[model samples]
Target: MNQRLNRTAVVKRAAELADEIGFEQLTFTRLGRALGIAPPGVYRHVSDLDDLRRAISHNSARNVAVVLSSACAGLSGHQALSALAQALRDWAAMHPAQYAALQIAPDPNDTEGQEAAHELISVFASTLRSYQLEGNDLIDAIRLIRSTLHGFITLELSEGFKLERPIDLTFERIIIALDAMLRGWAV
Candidate 1:
């Protein structure tokens, strides 16, 4: 039993530690020490750092999907999109490390990885469906929304938005523009 350790426990602790420090700064040695185990002992729970990252990303995506879906509950169209966007932004602000971990692209061959990706996509699809977007239009809508929001988030987190404009206002304006695009995107 490794004295009370399990894959879930290891991953949970590792993710918390990653948030405490930074994602890239996380290491098996540090995770093991945090979990009160030896470096090699971590191998029992995770294959390697990438494996651990993939696990974290999977869990993070699932968590965000739940959050976004809950935010959109009983809402539709722009209301749902706004809630989803704000929830994502707030979640990222709170869990910067886990949010960053969620950015790791899933390996196509990995079922677990792909499932996690689908978990997030399904949330987007549900919201987009309210707009009656189908086929490539729906896919492209999701992509445009993701690309714009992800870009803004990545820049904000990295302090790349050094400017005179307030980010909060900027994000609000971005959402308005995005919603406008979504409303007219089908045409």
Candidate 2:
């Protein structure tokens, strides 16, 4: 807290605060208070709240890419898919606020944000490569995987599931079904 707060440090702290509180509650005033600085002092690092949100979003995307890449290392196909899916679910569960940040689409004009977003997509696309998918097929497969995983994780995070059956069993069954679908993917 003694060192001069740089943009990177501010963004990192903002992400941590977002995880502690919720992203919606994150603001320059809150961040400044956390950093023991005035709101104007925070402006030296981030221009405003939207900028901070973008920074958080970019960081979230990069973090997810790193996690997914690590999870799928030395693995491929169904093995990779299972690891990647579980890693994503674990990440979402652990960092609900940052995970929410990841759900926001980056502004098209923001190069860094776009690149970070693409990095996440590339991780999923690479995992699906073993299925021999390419072009639109590859894109669709990526969407399917993301949508399925995101849907379940978001629902679980919101406590939307009211079933008596165990969620873990349901998640495992989902992975199995996805594996089968990937194996049988045509076109």
RMSD of each: 1.5, 1.2
* Model 2 lDDT, residue 112, Cα: 96
TM-score of predicted structure 1: 0.94
lDDT against true structure, model 1: 0.90
lDDT of 2 by residue, 1-187 (tens): 7276899999999999988989899988888888898878998888889899989999999999999999999899889999999999999989999999998898899999999999999999888888989899888889899999999999999999999999999999998899899889896
- Best candidate (score: lDDT): 2
> How many residue-pair clashes does candidate 1 contain?
0
Estimate, for each residue in 111-178, the C-alpha lDDT of model 1 and write its tens digit. Answer: 99899999999999998777889989999999998988889888887889988989999998998898
TM-score of each: 0.94, 0.96
